[model samples]
Target chain A: MLVRRFVRRIAQFLIVYGIGLAGLLGLKYVLALSDYVVPDISLILETAKEVIADYIPAVFSTLSVTILGQVISIILAFSVGIAGRKSSWLGSFIRVTAYNIQAYPIVALAPIIFILLGDGFISRLLIASMICYFPLLLSVLGVMAAPVRDIEHFYRATGRMTWQLEVKIRAFENLSKLTTVISGSATLAMAGTIVAEFVAANAGIGYSIRTALYQSDLAKIFVALFLIGIIISVYQGLLETVGTWIIQKTSTEASSHE
Target chain B: MNKKYALFTYILLFLPYSFLCLLIVTHSAQAKEHEIRYRLKWLFNTSVAGDIYANKAGYFAAQGLQVNIKEGSPEKNAINELELGRAEFGVASADQVIRALDKGARLVVLAQIFQVNPMQWIYRDDQPEIKTLNDLQGKTIGITFGGNDETIMRTLLTKAGIKEKEVKLSGVRFDFMPFFRRQVEVWPVYRNSQGVILQDKLTKEGEAVRFFNPAEFGVNFVANSIITSEEMLKEQPQVVEKFLTALLQGWEAAMNQENETKVLAAVKALDKNTDARIMQKQLASTRGLVLAEAEAKKIGAIDMPAWQQTEAIMLQAGQIKRAVQVEKYLQVR
Candidate 1:
């Protein structure tokens, strides 16, 4: 039954995506008939070749920044998230700060960041981390503090240490929520990395977009976007798989123990 | 045993001395390579061929300088970057310099790259000719809202006795489809780079394109010029001179007929998308703009009269509140 359900889900996704891809391909041809520049498969292939040869370094740079930022966010989320959930004062402070930081768009802070850090890998990394920082922290905190009566009574009755209760019991109970937050945060970090690269980077996908805009080369711009989309999709897909496996394993373990 | 202990002690002493010498050598080597950051007015293209060539051709390295060239977007203000000390040197247009001066950003112009501003309106030749500014009336023209093209177009319209209502100003957002579809009769493009590409594309579709140059009609808005913060000028005079000298040499080499292949190769490294054939034509146009009918010796020359005229035009357009002594900011060699 489980395998059949999973197959149905996969088929549903493939059908939807297949239709979307076909529609896009049809649109490309329709536009091509006019004087409008449209993306061709050959152009995409050529662009990919060029990017692999000349722009792979930038792709790696952006990935490195995103990975580093997401890792930092994971650390901050685990530590500060718990503190925020456990202490009312700390939680209020974290909420207010995160809200303020997230409210001010990264574009507005880019100049100040560029000034403070100078335009380099460090600035890009900071901007990416800043963006990824808040969402993960808030989600983890919210999940940890969620009032589940049964779990709460069990922890209290067992007289477990606060650390053990929070780390083992609470985290497992909220494993699925944590997984969703992490994947979203990772995507946010990728976006932040691109934005940072756009504002002040010397090289990267964002820089390529900027250059393409200046030249008004729509083909090159689309190519860069296509590459970036592929990258983000692959990264998110990996995260999703790992997240699902962990959630499944942990939930199964908890149910068996119960 | 006593001799072995003495030898070990001597080895330890020599290691420390050698390590100290290595540190001194490394520090001096690093010091020799004075790191400087330069920000461009626009992204990497043939427009910045000279600057990129300077770095790529070992001119900066030859001068014992390590230069980091940062590309700028339409949203980026090179003058602001210079003012904030994020970049030691930057490229700015006459309009931006005027605005920066009015806003109290102490920047000095180093070298004017494009002697003739390449910001011009491109129209399909099949359409009615825009030979005079009056011909532009009633036609939809594309302009980037906050760009130098907008400033130049506004100045020209005012000078031509055309009101805002007389001409339809369409705000362009990096999309050429509107222009291609004849939604905008005229579109702004850099004659050297984007203009060449546009013209080629249209020609392939059996449409001939012509550029309406503002300089030809006496507006003569100045384009990209090298700019450095006042503080950099005051403090690092030697470094500035060294950088300028090497940069000028690079520009000269890039523009030279014999070095076309080498220069274009360097440009292709930075701008991988532009076609080599189109780049050749763009390079030719770039050379014409930089030289501006002057002798080869006049490469990177600051056209003071042109600068004055540009400032006067900006003032007339009310782009700046007060008249700045533009001459005072020019550091022409």
Candidate 2:
């Protein structure tokens, strides 16, 4: 069984990676078809090095703020989502708030945060959290109340033999979906924070990009974009791994019950 | 007989004074309806270093325009604000103006504040291996976003005869300088600010960066343009003329010694962390750019041939898709 599992994993990895690599190569050629015009490559490289050295503290701090902010946002969203699903009043209120946040474009909130936080990290954190919070909340709440008709029957038959039955059995059942919602929102939050940071920051990847553009430094701009893309890509991979594990764990439990 | 004559004279003076007062108040009330809001390209910094001077110095008021300046997201956003009527005017580079005009936005350039592009190239002090653009062959280079900083790379690279894709492009983070220290060949910087900062820090440590100015290579382009909507131009010609005139006067006052110190003070009020000495140096650089066209008959001067030449450079370098008629965007109204 272990040998079979290993072989299957390798095959899956190879197939997915082969397709992805091909796509990346194709995209490069397409961009090259435009001749990939850039201004000040050497200058941009030097400036990027300069900004990184001077603003190392600010960059790390912004990254940490981005991670912590998503954590807080996810926790609050889950709590609110659970409560709303369980209670009618909160459901109405949460529905309204989520819709309101969704109505505004994520980037539009940057200036507001700038006014509140004076081009500070807190402002970026708040704006990013607000943008990501809505999607996470909706996903968690909707997944919790998802139409699994037999789930109620299973609970009825068990007749609350133990509180653990209610907490672990039903909640754990949707764990896969929960991680999906969380991971997606976390990635979205990262993008939102960068955009906010771009408009009102003195330091961070966003500010670096702006300075590069002003100087007509194309190399630095591309480098920044590449880094951001890598970060988001890694986050997505990790989340998908966790999601797969959760789904497998839940599936076995359901089959065992049968 | 003397008391009767004095009372008659007092009544005669009071009637004329009150009537003039009424006329002055009524005219001001009518003018108040026209508020010209401009969205600046950068934050309230030393660039618009003269705006507060313009306001407090009565430059805008003299022209019958109450101008409210706000910060913008710098590019397309500024254009959108003008289109949406959130801002009557927007500030950006001439390239952006060309792009906006192509997008079917009826905009006009009111003034050109920066005489030359401050965009430049930088290398570490005494890095012999990577001294010039030719040295960047087969090396890893850092870039922020390739699209925004359009022509600087193509101009420098093609001039040196470096083939496209010879140098590998790496992801840009705040770590540009680190890449340089760790052996990245070259970097882009603003000569006035970033270059100054690096120069100050390095020079103090007995180090300096080998720098190249894009303008020296015939890449003289304008930065920080003042632009307005065409609809506003048609409807409020008087307001536009008054605003442009006042803004020009404001620049004049800011450049003078006595008022310049005051203008610098206003810049400090907005950003407390910037050093005064640094600002002074920046002011000197700004002065040269602002006054480069001082001899011309017009205050906010536009060079058509130079613009066409820049467009041609980009075109020759295959950066721009097609030749853009530079005159369509610069309607001096």
Chain B TM-score per candidate, please: 0.86, 0.78
> Per-residue lDDT tens digits of candidate 1, residues B1-333?
999998897576456555654553454234223578888988888878889899999999999889998898755667656644457788877777876676456789999888889888899998888878899899999886545687789988988999999989986644477788798889999899889899999999999999999999988778888999788899999889988988888888888888899999998998898889999989998888887766643677887888888888778866655798798899877
Best by lDDT: 1
Measured by TM-score, the strongest candidate is 2
Candidate 1 global lDDT: 0.76
- The lDDT of model 2 is 0.64
Weakest lDDT window of 10 consecutive positions for candidate 2 chain A: A31-40
Candidate 2 has an interface RMSD (Å) of 22.4
TM-score of chain A of each: 0.81, 0.71
Question: What is the C-alpha lDDT profile of model 2 across A25-86, one tens digit per residue?
Answer: 34334322111122233434554675556445545555666677788788888678666765
DockQ each candidate and list the results.
Answer: 0.03, 0.02
